[model samples]
Target: MAWSFWQIQELNKNYDLTIVGAGFTGLHTAIAFKRKYPKASVLIVDQGLGVNAASNRNAGFACFGSPTELLANYQHLGRDAALTMAQKRREGIEFLAHTYGKACDYVPVTSHELFLDAKHDFEHVVSELKLLNADLKSVGFATETFKPSLNAQLEINQIEICGEGQLNPAKLHNALLDNCRAVGIQFCNAKFIDHQLLQDDIAVELEGGMIIKTTALVLATNGFSNTTNIKPARAQVLITEPIYNLQLEGNYHFDKGYYYLRNVGDRVLFGGGRNLDFETETTTDLSLNEFIQSHLENLLRNKLLQNVPFQIAHKWAGIMGIRQDGTPKVEVLGNHIFRIEGMSGMGVALSPVLAQELVELL
Candidate 1:
């Protein structure tokens, strides 16, 4: 596609900043930079019509971490680093609520980590519940974070409950886009093909042979980073048709946060099962896997709904970037290029503050 004269002129003009991938992080980064430099020319470019990643497709979990997930993080990353990440997640949720307002349909409910069997893993989580709560409190949580509960009706031996919540991801994304536009930020629906760090500017190549030069560049592509270290894992999700007398109210996680489900009004939005086929799931392809999808359905029917009559209304997949350490990566790639990716599936609750942190590095 050849660019018109005006389009070519616009592409030739150097921008103050150009951000790639208008997902949660990109939008927020643009907003933060624009707020700092109100008169600066800022442009956001995304490949899809809207954010086609987990920003809109996520299960909308306003969570920091489940008990078991926190334990794993603590063991892997050590206590201080783990607690700091948890603190960032909590602050990110607060920032979203304050900035986007309640119109995002934020719902505060108990997040549960269910243990299907009374096994050693369950015992470890139960044993460390108090320590987890203490760690959360040290990070400014007003009260205890996790407590043990039983749900005999679901045939679960134990559930670690915490004061977590959910929100509509689509609504949040729309709100961010609208706010960015209101503040005079430009957005273009074009894929970013490549970038080069010039002496004083960065040249960004788009899909249609358009080259945009900017003083600074930010790669907020998250799961779509396409870098060597960052691996994209696709998560498949399904929503069921409205069930009568739906009892599920809060977000639930199991098997170390690989599987999560939440109630969307009277319907259940369930996702996760990448653990079943990690090799196949570690792709940027937004297609469903029959093996994983079937397993999710069986889990929904037998364990979640207890064999209750229900039909799946929709199914989709979203890619998430994961790092070796299971933490987000925000750093400067070059003198003029900054990259923020590898959310490790916690982009929903981490991107807001992560965006701020990334912008501060500018």
Candidate 2:
């Protein structure tokens, strides 16, 4: 179903607890709030029909921070902070599975990526592995091993696979919505603004010139974090029509997982490479770019599916929050409003954890 301006405007009026942005974070936050205070009014509002910024747009891999990702984050932060963030993502994924069963198509596949080409890529992976192994082994969570195989059918350079996985993105979001509804959580297509904390109520103004009087307001916008400085960056995606005798399987990443593709039965879904053009791809817009699209296409032609007869069936983009610290901003906006944006590309694994934190904060 689609929405009209009037319908959204009508939903803009008062509520006890109004959650902005009905993505994974928002939906889960709504569920948490309802569970904590069953009699309290809990409403979720979004500008769209509860589609995720990157939630539905993600590769759906139940990952616990890839090695290079951890290394990159470690440089920005430190070893302890990066590992803590990784653990938060780790536990968050566990909670999601506990909340929504594996029938959501949540499968744990090979998590570590291969750096088959580019000397720099190989070196980076090695460095990342060194740091990560030290941390993982400290707690007996290490799962790295050196192995070689042509399983991917590519003349790539290395094979480092273990402890990674994939799932259906839209299914996760829909399941979350289903559970929220089951718990009597109400949602509407509305936007929020103008947070005013009164002596007794927190007044939130909507775009429709109406106000929502809630005891608490929470922000779970993730990459669509336009309400504040939470900048959600765009990542594009592509899909290929069902193919015959495809060799791709499991969640595989190359070039530091900047490029990823996996098979959903017979169809192949691929994304990433925004790192090749950061400035251009770093936008909140839900549109695709020619340079990155062409780059991915060329990779398919020259690297993966060379000369294979296949047609591009779909092309789209999703938003991921970005910040100096690679952590979702889960803090109180004021006395009554709280912010939970910036999932950093790890929203799929991290947002749910932040949602639980939001519940605690409330």
Candidate 3:
């Protein structure tokens, strides 16, 4: 496609920095970098083609580390790395609380982890909780971050944990967008195709033959990133129509955090099950998976809300970036180009901190 002078003049604008992706990491990175350099001209461009960004579609659990998840991390990444992960999560949550405050609809409700009798006996779960709590205490968290609890309504063994909460992800995204605009940041809606490093600037190629030039470029596409080390994991989620006299509250986790449920007003929001068909779920596609979605509905009907007559109000999926080895990627790809991704489904409580780290590289 040949670019006309009028079209080129209208579409091409040079910026001090350009960020791709409009999700948490990209938005936060833009805000942090603009704040550090108040006069810098920043533009954020995203494909905005579908409901693919996990930032706005996640279950909104302001979670750091669930017990079983932390235990697995400890086994896989060593005690020090696990502790570091926990600490970073805590810090990220704190940053949200301090920075966005009530704008995100944050509710510091008690978080619960349910152990279905079919999967775990009470005695065994208690032992695991003890070990998890002890490890948490070593890093300034209360020795009893998790305490034994029961949900008599569901007849399941559970544990209550502190220092975790829930929020409306959409609200958080809006708040970030508002802040970015308030700081004079610009936004463009376009499909990114490729980029080239020039002598003095990077030329970003968009669909329809549009090009944007910037001194620095940042990729925050996460799961959609075309990197070998990172893979996209699609999380399937559903919500029940508001049930009368619903008693569920706060964040809930089960099956080693592969499945989760929480109450949003009288509606129950639940998600996960990528573990059921890892191969199929490991794609950037946002369509629903019948097998995983069926399993979730079964759990909702027979396990989570048994005998409680309700109807599914909605169903959707979000793509999250993950690494095979369970490590985050925040590094420079080349001169003046950076990659900040691979949250592995923990982007909610990790993006803020990771965004700051990415800004430091600038």
Candidate 4:
């Protein structure tokens, strides 16, 4: 694909900042940078037509962290680090709601973490619920954010309710794109190939020999972080046809947040099963795995929507970036290049703040 003269000139325009990957983080980072440096030329580029990652494909839970997930984070990253991460997520969700407006079909519903019999320590989570809620309160979350309860009808040992919500992912993405464009930020749908550090600028090479030079660069590819410490993990999801008089509402997590389901109107949107095949799921491929898909279907039929009649409507997969420490990696790679990745499957609730944090480093 040879570029025309005008196209080449446009591609070669010197930008003050260039960001790769026009997903949640990339777009938000561009917005943040543009707001701070209104006169600076900013550009964002991505390979996909739209956000083809978990940003647009996520289950849309406006969640900070599930009880079990927070407990695990506390165990792995300790109390202080976990609290900090939680605070970021909380602030991120609030920022998103504020920016996009509450009319983006966001529902303030209770999120639940369900534990099956003898599978997890229900009492242990119950014991720590108060402590976890306190930790959240310390970070500005509402007190008693997590509480223990039981729903025998759901066949669970225990359930914890918390302040979480759901939103329209597509709406949020489009809103950000509109906001970015309205603010005079340029976006190009080109795949980033490589980047090199020049004396005073970073030369970013896109596919087909197109190069974009910028004084500063940001890599917000998240799970698509090809060369960084971020590991790509694919999550498969399916939605069911509308069921008659469906009573389920709110978001749900089971098996330590490995599986999740939420009511999309009268239909149920279910996803997650990476734990069943971590090796295979740890890839950037946006393809479904029958082994995992079948398990999800079985779980949906036997556990989630048992005795309820419904048909499968759609199935898809999205990739997420995971880090060993379960924290997003946002750091300055050089004076001119910055890298942000490892959302650890919490990009929806973390990217907004992470983007602002990345801009602060500029």
lDDT of 1 at 145: 78
Candidate 4's displacement at residue 155, Å, is 4.0
Instruction: Give the per-residue Cα lDDT of candidate 4 at 193.
Output: 94
Q: List the residue pairs that clash in candidate 3.
A: none
Best by TM-score: 4
Q: Clashing residue pairs in candidate 4, if any? A: none
Candidate 4 per-residue lDDT, tens place, 74-144, comes to 88899999899989988887887777756467777888887866768888888888888888999898988
Per-residue CA lDDT of model 1 for 142-257, tens digit only, reads 57778787876696655656657789888888888777878977777688999887877888899989888899999888778888878998999999999999988888988778
Q: Write the per-residue lDDT of candidate 3 for residues 55-120, one digit (tens) a residue.
A: 878899888777777777888999888888888888888889888859998878888888886655
- What local lDDT does model 2 show for residue 48? 70
| Number of the predicted model whose lDDT against the real structure is largest | 3
TM-score of each: 0.94, 0.89, 0.92, 0.94
What RMSD does model 4 have? 3.1
Clashing residue pairs in all predictions, respectively, total: 0, 5, 0, 0
* Candidate-wise lDDT, in order: 0.82, 0.72, 0.85, 0.82
lDDT of 2 by residue, 1-362 (tens): 22331143334356778888877888878888888888887878777775545777777777766566666777878877877877776777677667674647777666436655566465546655655776865544545532334544666555555545677878888788777767867776666656787888888777778677888888777766664566657787888888888766777666655777778878777888888888877787888987888888778767777767788889888888876455665877687688888876677778877888878878
For model 2, the stretches where C-alpha displacement exceeds 4 angstroms are 1-14, 121-124, 127-131, 139-152, 159-161
**Residue 178 deviation, candidate 4, in Å?**
0.5
lDDT of 3: 0.85
